[model samples]
Target: MKIIYRNNDRYAIKKLLLDIGEPELERECWRRKLHKPRRINLFFLETNEGITSLKYKYPQKGVETIIDVSQYDLPECGWIRYKIPY
Candidate 1:
């Protein structure tokens, strides 16, 4: 699967998966976390299948935290991607 983050371009899961065993992808993920702004807001993930999920992430005490939406009936997409601005 692929995602278009912040309108930059679509990125495949291979480019963003943390457990993919790719050093460059891991570095890119870190770079994104570092560059992402620290704010409380909603983020959207839209899939090619027309399913959308809402999420949020922030830093808490030096650790990155994500607002859990696991209770919601999100579609079984392979992974989360495509950060839409709120």
Candidate 2:
């Protein structure tokens, strides 16, 4: 999911947890360093060939950012890039 934050191009990569749901809240996170939380509603892209064995744990600290989908520990076959603000 390409997010447009401050009109900058940044990317994040993570494994897809579940199939994209209907128009709903996208992944979100909070940063204590900045003192505020960030939320975004990303569109649902198709679920293509993904890493079956490779798994990813969700962020607990609440750090939301654009995802690059290719940086997962498993070299699965999913790709996503999101635009975000720091």
TM-score to native of every candidate shown: 0.22, 0.18
Local accuracy of candidate 1 as per-residue lDDT tens digits, 60-84? 4343322222333443444535644
Count of backbone clashes, every candidate in sequence: 0, 7
Best by TM-score: 1
The positional error of residue 35 in candidate 1, measured at the CA in angstroms, is: 23
Taking all chains together, the TM-score of candidate 2 against the true structure is 0.18
In terms of lDDT, the poorest run of 10 residues in model 1 is 5-14
